[model samples]
Target chain A: MKNDILTVMWKERKGLFRIRGRRAQALLGMFSPVLLAIFFPLQEGVEWVQSPLSLLLAFVAPLILVGMSIPDSFAGERERHTLPTLLASRLSDRAILFGKMITSVAFGWGVTLVLLAIGLVTVNIAHWDGHILFYKPSILLADLAFSFLVAMLTAGAGVLFSLRAATAQEAQQTLMAVLLIPPMILQFGLFAIMGSDSGKARLQEVLGALSFEQIILVIVAVLLVLDVVLLMAAMSRFKRARLILD
Target chain B: MPSGIIFGFLGPNGAGKTTTINLLLGLLEPTSGRAEVLGLDTRTQPDEVRTRTGALLEHSGVYEQLSAEDNLEFYGRIWRMPATERQARIKELLSHMGVWERRKERVGTWSKGMKQKLALARAMLHRPPLVFLDEPTAGLDVMAAAAVRDDLEALAGREGVTVFLTTHNMAEAERLCSQVAVIREGKLVAIGDPDDLRARSGGPRLEIVGRGFDENALGLLRARPEITAAEVHGDHLVIDLRQETDTAPLVSLMVSAGVQVEEVRRGKASLEEVFLTLMEEER
Candidate 1:
């Protein structure tokens, strides 16, 4: 099973790369860093990585961005109606499904890494008293790998939904709901909740109390569990998938 | 009779043909039955089926950016055919499908006919023992459809490849099919040799084409009680003879009637006719 999945993925390596267009590449590159820049806007006149939100965004941005690739991965094939051809091949459903999932997650990581590179370049170029902004390069890289795990979670969820939805639009919408809700809550709702709270000092204390290492481990744990759970769901629920209308 | 028997699936639009094809390929699970290919149950060994057989669905596609040769090679690799074998197999398929000249061109730019032939080449690239095709020539022009038909028939006869063909073209089915299975909605309404199904469905139906016969000659032929039913098919009249009836009486009557009998054929009804009969039976 492992060999079959890997073989199919390798065979499709060229075509899959071609399908990941410049738009997707650009989106992936910009998403992580831009989120970081937003949380710690460069124009805000703060050091690149000092802003907790920006630092957190950079760590979590890849996780969120990875999910975006999932909807397209499975939904794209469903939209093109090519699922049957693959299903009819000698490879089993689980193998083909997992192969697609792995490929999608790989792309998610690939794009996130590209963004990471871009972020590192921009941060290094920033004039920080002739100093690098983020102190934990190793940590960020580790977080990027964690983001890859989170991407597997999102990809698995997207594929499960994509299998049944009659049209790509529905599959995308289904995946979008799952992908967008959690990270979006973190992205937009965090500030909202913080602003509405009158305990400004308490929030500051909490922000300052955050140990970057703790956040890294927490995210990693969550990402690992999510990846395993969602992957299991996607593989198991595949049998129940019926082609449904938008 | 062999390990894998290629059954031609015939039906009209919305006749559950694609549904059946999907069931066979393990794409959609049977509503309440079983699908096994090569001793590997779809429910148990889907990957096994996928690796063993190659399929070209009704609306299969390839990345627009890649050349046809690349598509073949890519799928070949997925089937785990070694690089050297894949190269030789792809070359042979491209040459045989008559797309060798344009193999370098991106599939997105190919004509409908070119793409159909390329799809066939891709399906056969791995040299899978079993193949499932859904309306393989649904959108191809006459020449291209004919070419694909030839490829499929030759694949079955020469290569001994099992081709589970799915199509709505009655004439094409009759031309190439060794055995046929007709489905309606979701039920297997008929299954057997094309000739047998046609004969049983229409009950020994026959068609004659020539000058008209007078009632006296018809009466003489009918006196034997061999003729059961007859109908007009275009310019000629179709006659259905009773079981165990000989054709000598009809020929004698036609000759005596001074009618120029240009053709005397015993046609076990056509696929279309059989399907229509099945539909009527269902109704």
Candidate 2:
């Protein structure tokens, strides 16, 4: 099983950038994140590394990157008529699922790490003082955990959509829409709560009671649970019989 | 059904040829009955069956963006062929298919025939004991189809693998398959050797190339108890026989009646004719 998953990863690695017209799209998709990595550090100077500003790049980069990849890895195979042959091979369903999920997560999380490094470099070069500035240990840890979890979240959700989608574009569009819902709801909930003085007071009271570390830990724990739930859902749906029919 | 012969599974569009192949591969479960491949129950041991078999499904199933070598290389890895052995086998198969020179080019750039050939090479890369090909030559031009057919025949012969081939091309079935089965609406209608099916579908036939075929000669030939139907198509007289019988007496009768008989050919029905006859009978 391990060998089979590795074999699948081997193929996925080759196909990641080599697919027709995908290179251009991938480069174009990287443009925004690249810009953020450079522009934010230059604008914010030392705050980019010491504060939570870099976390934005960490969260959004993996979501977009993994979003672009998981659909293509899953639905693109079906759209191009290769999934049947792959499923017909000696590969078990779990190997295929984990192989694709791992590849997408690695690509997304790996690229986010690079972008974060680029931001750090941009900040140091822009604000060259007596010493080089780097991301604070806490910020760096949060960025890593958040980016990795977001990558997993996107991959898990993307697989579910890809399994039912007829085309890669459809899966991608649907995944993006679904990913937007949580933040949209959070924004609305925050707005509504802050709109009322009493509600805002209560929120600040609750927040004031907890340390930043506790809050970060709580969010991480929630994301970890969601990631596991989505992964389990993807595994349950990734049956060979179901995929063949799809 | 045997160990090392191409068994042709004949069916029309949507006649469940692909479905049956999926079942045998364990990609789809049998709602009722069960199947076994290489003595492994498809229901209980499908992975084992798939490990021992290869398949070229309805589609070519090749990655168009990847080079041909990469395509075969990926499957070679899937089967866990060692690096050296996989490379050598890829070279051997691609060389045999006469596409080794073009192995570095993306398959999407190749013509349909070439892509189909590459897909074939991928299927045979593992040298499995059995391979299932679903309409392997389905959408190719005449020359391209023949090229694929030749490759299939040579590879199957060289590998000594049992090929479970599904095709509507009866001529292809006749040439490549030692035994054939016809299915319609998910049920087996007929199963036998090509010759046996041909003979069973229609009786012996006689065609006489002559310039003096007339209604009078046709009438006399049709009156014989052994002849089922006789018709003159231009200068040729075609006689459908009730059974295999001596044609000398009939030729002598035609000559005595002043009908010029230039050449007489005795033959059984072709596989295509047999397939059509079976379909018509089922209807």
Candidate 3:
């Protein structure tokens, strides 16, 4: 099973990097991340690593990156007419699913970490801090865990959308729309919460009651359950016969 | 049923040929029946069956973005062929297809024929005991189709692997298949040697290219008990005779009827004619 997963990953990586126009798209995708990694740290100095805003970067990085990649990975295979052959191969359902998911997650999370690390170096070199600048252990842990969870969430959702989509572009667009819904709902919920004095008082009381660590833990826990549910849904929907018919 | 023979699966469009191949390859479940490949039940042990069998599906299923070598390398890994063996096999297959020098070029850049050769190489890379090829020459030009056919023939001959080949080209089936099965609407209509089908698909046929075949000659030819069908097709008189009937008597009768017979030919029905007749019967 491990070997099979690796084999799928090998193909995924080759396809991601070596495909004709995809190479250009990938390089272009990296441009924004590289710019952020360098410019943000130089501008903010050690505060870039010290603040919780770095966690926001980490979270958004994976959301964007994984959202972009997972659709291309799953829907792209079907669009290119390669999915049937892959399905007809000896690889098990779990192996192919996990292999593709892992590749996208790894790419998103790996690049996020690299960007954060580069940010650290840029802070140290350009800002000329007397001592080394790095993320606090708690902040770093939150970044890794949250970013990974978000990446998994995006990938899981991407698979579901890709399964039904006719083309990779359509899958990507639909997934992006789905991803925006959560934030939109959150915005509406926050507005409702702050609409009245009683609601604002309750919100403040809840926030005041929990420490940042406790809040982060709660968010991560919710994300973990959502990730598992979405992943399971994607797995159950991935039927070979259905895919072939499509 | 035998190993090391190229079996041709012949059928018209929408005849469930692809569906049957999918079931045999364990990509789909049968509604009421079962299929086995390489001694493994496709329903219960699909992975095992797939592990031992290779398929080039209806589409080439080649990654157009990857080079020809990388495409084979990818499938070779899927079959878990080791690095050394995979490299050697890729080289061998590409060389045999006469595309070894262009292995590094992207498949999309190559002509349709070249991509098909590479796809065939990928299908045979793991050296499975059996392979399924679905219309390997479906969309190629005349020269390209002929080239692919040559490669398919050579590889099938040299590898000694069981091949389940589905093709619309009866000529290809006639040329390469040891046994052929004709299916229509998800059911097997006829399965036998091509020659046996041709023989059983009515009987011996005779064509007389002549200018003097009139209604009297046609009526007389059709009225005979031994002649099943006699019709003027363009400038020739085509007659379908009952099995084992001699043509000499028919020729004598036509001459007596004042029909000018410029040339006489006795032949078995071609595979295409048999296929059309079966479809007509089914309809």
lDDT (tens digit, per residue) of candidate 1 on A18-56: 553635664665655565644343444334444343345
For residues A1-246, write the lDDT of model 2, one tens digit per residue: 898888888888888977777788889889889999999999999999888899899989999899988998778999999999999999888999999999999999999999999999999999999798988898899999999999999999999999989998899999999999999999999999999999999999999999767887888899999999999999998889888988
When sorted by TM-score, best at the front, the candidate numbers are: 2, 3, 1
TM-score of chain B taken alone, every candidate:
0.88, 0.95, 0.96
Would you estimate the TM-scores of all the predictions? 0.81, 0.97, 0.96
| Fraction of the reference Cα-Cα interface contacts (below 8 Å) that each candidate reproduces | 0.62, 0.92, 0.87
List, residue by residue over A1-246, the lDDT tens digit for candidate 3.
999889889888877766557667677767777777788888887788877767767877788888778887767888888888888888999999999999999999998898888888888899884777778888999988998999999999998998878888899899999899998999999999999999999999999999888998999999999999999999999988899889
lDDT at A31, model 2: 89
State candidate 1's DockQ.
0.40
Candidate 1 wrongly placed segments (more than 4 Å): A11-13, A16-46, A49-68, A123-134, A137-146, A167-170, A183-210, A240-246, B1-6, B31-46, B61-65, B185-190, B196-221, B232-234, B243-271, B274-283
Cα error, candidate 2, residue A119 (Å): 0.7
Residue B56 in model 2: lDDT: 95
Model 3: CA > 4 A from native: none
Range of the 10 consecutive residues with the lowest summed lDDT in candidate 3 chain A: A17-26
For residues B121-226, could you state the per-residue lDDT of candidate 1 as single tens digits?
Answer: 7787777788888898897889888887887777667677888888878888888777888877777788888888877877675566787666665566557677
